[model samples]
Target: MDVDVLIVGAGPTGLALGIDLARRGVDALVVERGETLAPGSRGKGLQPRTLEVYEDLGVLDEILAAGGAYPVGMIWTDGEQVGRHAMFDPAEDGEEGSRFTGPWMVPQWRNQEILLARLRELGGTVAFGREVVRIGQNAEGVTAHFASGAPVRARYAVAADGGRSAVRRALGIPMAGETLDPDRALVADVRIPELERTWWHVFPPSGPDSGFLALCPLAGTDQFQLVARLSAGAEPDLSPEGVRKLVAERTHLAPEAVTELLWASDFRPRAALADRLREGRVFLAGDAAHVHSPAGGQGLNTSVQDAYNLGWKLGAVLGGRAPEALLDTYEEERRPVAEHVLGLSTAILRAEARRGAATRQLGLNYRHSSLSEETRRDPGPLSAGDRVPDLTVDGVRLFDRLKGPDWTLLTLDSGVFLVRPDGYVGWAGDTEDGLGTYRARVGLG
Candidate 1:
């Protein structure tokens, strides 16, 4: 076998999963089609839940140091401020096991850099410019054929490739769901007038039907990224006047005030999920498994979460410590979550289409799981299944408890609960009630 695991694509999802696999001492290799790591800012905001995952990977401090912090949430249509509802801060509520207290605003490229550096520090490097042409699998292992006519074998394979995944297609997996609508949205990084004071502005100067604008403050006031949702019918022209007119209609800015235009491209919102996240020994993650509207900034976050869910399971199974059935749970757990999240984003878009005034956000609540059953109440406002409320536990906070890439096993009073690496409780009966059996089931024995 070429390695224990082969990861295709070196974007956020691929790199994050590579970091986890390397930390677990798993022999892994990541392949990317791009020769150089992407530098542009496709995704800018890191949700609280994703920040918590980065904290667990032992890189949150580095991430914060590299990126700026934004504590405030959405500025409502009525101009009311809605905070991020502190999920990982100890000073505010003193919740144990909480690490990331709020959401963060960091360019997606920076986050990928951190993950890539961590992977290299752990003695693993992503092989860029080397795309996989095809893949074949059998009972022994899986083999990936490269564009250079070289075949690499591994015990298992994971397709972290982007939305248009060649690996997924080679495996003949059907991606079932919606595609981009007729509307076309343009994203461009530019120098706007009076920047760096605010992180994001949803209400556009052009009005709601004209689509909202997202202003991302970069390193200085002179530099910023302005992502606006333009009409699908907007002519595709990068001329100064063309760009100026769009910005003017949205922000009422003067032509010269727009200053410089860096990069401009058009894309549409799409919602899709693979018929199945796994087929035999090859598994799919990130955009390969699902795609959705970028309204809630959950696209990249969801992909990273997908990688987080699959990484440790792949490690455990390859290391002979876990049954293959454990790998099946990845789809069982994340597919439903993706479906729910995509549906919510679609609803938000529909609402936005009608110029409705609703604070758009994606809330993840696992009320369907067994561990969440303990609460026994609908996840109204807040509940146990809702990202496991960050609370203080005997001075060791929940976020702090996620200091490494290992099972957490958090209990109300240390009652022998079993947690998976992805932060899901596998078994949570009682401390005195067959701990060994539960441990065996969780591969912790």
Candidate 2:
């Protein structure tokens, strides 16, 4: 095998996996179909949970510096501002329990830049224009054949490819979930007359037939992304002229004022999840595993997180330091989380389109597993419906003590908590007897 693991895709998911694996001193190869790193802002808004993951990867500071701080979170409206929940605000929730208080809005392009730079610094380069054409697995390892006729072997293969995943297709894996919705949303990044002090504005029922308009300011650029639900067969051009007309009709702006259309693209909402996140020695991550609506900007963040969860496990398994069962936890841990994100985003979009009741701000808490048996059970496994709590127990901040390579064990009141390498809690108990039992379960005994 030319490498320990083969990663297919060079976007945030693949690059993030590369950074994690390389930093851990693992031999991995990342391949991408694009000739060069894509240059455009597709997704923005980094969730607070993702920031904690980035912190674990040692790149949170850089991401924070490059991104814009958004103190105010998403606003829900049923024709009027019905709910305005704070997402990431330490002041609102207090210091200890506010794990992800405020989310930073960084363009996806910029985040990719940082990931690529970090990967290079760690002595790894993503091989561009390398598309995997065929993949074969044996008892010992796997071999991948690229379109360029290069054969690369590895102990494991991960499909971080996009929605149209070639590797997943080749493996005959089925993508199971809801079909793509019929609604067509027109998106464009353009410089319009200043929105003044407002950060985001949503005009509900902006058009006849329950259509709405969402205007959000883009950080680091003198542009605002306009998303409007178009009428069926409305045929709105994304060009400057079309955006001008849409803005004028939906808001107070005049058509003549909107100019400088930077980029425009149209997308249909689709929610899907791979039937299985792994197949034999091959695994899937990012859009290759699941895709959600762009309503809350969770698409990229979730996929990047999938890689973050899977990278360390793959490295450990391939390095012969952990049992093969550790890899199964990747799907066990993330599939349910993605399921929650998909449903939450779907609800957000439906509410926006139909002016329904506002759902709670998105939150993810892992409460399903043998490990949770020792601790108080959460309502259920982490869902997009629940917020992850931050540190502040027994006069210590969890993040403050959570630096370094090993998984952190944290307890609030003289107890033991086993944190998995991917940052998930494997066990938590207040008594040594309970801790010992859970520790043995996690292979920590």
State which candidate has the highest lDDT: 2
Write one digit per residue (lDDT tens) for candidate 2, span 1-445.
7899888998889999998899888898899888988655677778766777788777888888886865343443543455444432333444424455555778777888888888999888789889888999998899999889579999998998888899999999999877456768888877766554255766666445646776677776666777888776677687788888877776666787676787787777899999999999999999899988876667787888888778877776666666788788788878888887788778766653321111112345456643344454442342211233555667766666765445675544444556666555666555444666655554555
C-alpha RMSD for every candidate: 5.3, 4.7
What is the Å distance of residue 392 in model 2 from its true position?
5.1
Which tens-of-lDDT digit does each residue in 67-173 have in candidate 1?
77543323334343434332122223223234444446677777888888888998887888887998999998999998874788998899998889999999999
Backbone clashes, candidate 2: 5
Task: Per model, state how many residue pairs clash.
Answer: 14, 5
Candidate 1 deviant stretches above 4 angstroms: 69-102, 179-181, 193-196, 199-214, 219-222, 238-245, 352-389, 398-402, 408-414
Supply candidate 2's per-residue lDDT for 105.
Answer: 79
